[model samples]
Target: MDEPRGDYWYNLVTGKVEVGAQSDWTQLIGPYASREEAEHAIEKVHERNRSWEQGEED
Candidate 1:
């Protein structure tokens, strides 16, 4: 059987990584696969936005 992957969230209001859905939906960024990914959620979003503005596709 495959191991279960945990859900991680990035709190937009507090700018912190959470283990799960512990905050209000409006303030959380996502269900990232890992803590490290959750920590960089904002950075990833900004990067993607910039790419879109430059006519680039990921």
Candidate 2:
């Protein structure tokens, strides 16, 4: 099977999803593998922060 190759970006300012450098780097969240993953960028950030906090507490 063929695989898809591209980076996904979530626009913080416009609350949008982009594929492969659609907008400037400063406005984007990531480099995520899929559009769906990019769409949940905010949630992922929060989750990551929580993990970091938990780690610090340990």
lDDT of each: 0.87, 0.84
Q: Assess candidate 2 and give its TM-score to the true structure.
A: 0.69
Query: Mind giving the per-residue lDDT tens digits that candidate 1 earns over 1-58?
Result: 6423568899999999888789999999989988888889999999999989888543
Q: Predicted candidate 2: what Cα RMSD to the true structure?
A: 3.5
List model 2 lDDT by residue over 2-51, tens digit each: 33545888999889887777788899888888878889998889999999
The lDDT of model 1 is 0.87
Q: Which ten residues in a row have the lowest lDDT in candidate 2?
A: 1-10
